[model samples]
Target: MNWQDEAMRYEPLKAQDLYDFATAEQKQEAVEAYNRAVNKLRSGNGDVAGIALRQLAAQYPDFAEAGLLSVCCQMLWGDRRGALQILQRFSQAGYLTEDESFKTERYLAAVSSEPARETEDPGAVVVMDGENLRRDTVKPPRLLRRASADSGVEVASASEQEAFLREHNLNLKKHHYVASRSSNLLIKWLVTLLIILLLIALLLVVFLLLPQGGKTGAAATASPGLLNWSGLRLWRPVNLFQA
Candidate 1:
């Protein structure tokens, strides 16, 4: 099918059910679909995205990326069992990349443990997912008195805000580091491929630009010598010994 074809056309898990799985090109198509689904999630249509991701992962069993995103979508929707089911499926297939595997492990760990109750609502707090539920954090000193905030807004104390910022920053740094490491690997391979292609092209050009062998030498050797005499009417070959 063309790239524009609907992702839902294939039956759920059909591709993954195949023993050989997808070819490299087919896998690329799946990757594109996965990306589209991810964008859909950002647009707030997480259901469509999640379904597409599930089908994609199941269709191409080895596509670890699709599986990971599918799990993430389920997790976002708070479907613990469903998310774990998908995770367990591909995880058993052994296609999950290192990062995906690590996340899966964390998801399982968090699921097995008690759910942290502190982060039930959005707030200016540092509570990580499924962490710091029961524990109380000390309130930091406030610089100014609390302002009369809007009714709808839930303004946290200064300490809670600070804690949120700190946690957010740490999480951002950690994620950025991990993402950069993976991206650098892809960049390295791409650059190496480009260099190899450039070298090949240069060699081809050099070979083409080089002069063919022996033509000039043969023509020079076949020509009359400079000492050959020329009359007013016509040129003539020289007989040096007779002269």
Candidate 2:
């Protein structure tokens, strides 16, 4: 049978079923690993977080949360095909339900609508015959409930989550370029304004000094012998007495 036919033969595995089969230590290890991956994601290291999450999901194939988070990381890192593949796996496993927030996740909206084979990654196509899908259904586990509360990852809506991821993925270099360019323009304008003010002050000083110098030169020309007071004043006082 083809992989698709094989995948169709088995019932989908639920999160609770996988949880039931896991040992306490295994559950503990999975939670710790998930926490570490979440920390990496929170610190804006999506690439590292993606790798960690993928590894965690691979190590614990039944950990639906790990697979889901890894899908988010893949989307954030621009790996649509990878994200789609994970989503397909979970969908086949019945991890994705009608009410799951992933149904409305914008990243998957386009991918879900199109044919999986059209993706550049051939592996993006679902492989249902894998051992990962060969599991029995069971009751839900407590770890799923407690992990949601303690993991520190916000259980916001899919849109909000996508917004959060986009916020982190913003092109910082573009922002820096715009900011630096704006600052340079502002500095140029300030310098130009300062140069204009200085020129105006210099012109005012020249104009004031020029008028004062002109008045001084005119007075000197009007009374060329003004410095020689002895030429007339002393003789006029003595002549008044003798006459």
Compute each candidate's TM-score over C-alphas: 0.36, 0.36
Please, what are the lDDT tens digits per residue for candidate 1 over residues 1-243?
Answer: 121122232222334433333554564455556656656666554554554565566565556556666656545544456556666654554545576577667656654463544333322212222224221222111112223333322345555444543442311111111122234567999999999999999999888766644565455445665322342233457787884
Clashes of each: 1, 0
Span of ten consecutive residues with least summed lDDT in model 2: 136-145
For candidate 1, what is the TM-score?
0.36
Please write out the lDDT profile of model 2 over residues 60-94, one tens digit for every residue.
55466666666655554345677676666555454
- Model 2 off-target regions past 4 Å? 1-18, 95-110, 113-243
- Off by more than 4 A, model 1: 1-21, 90-95, 114-243
Report the Cα lDDT for candidate 2: 0.46
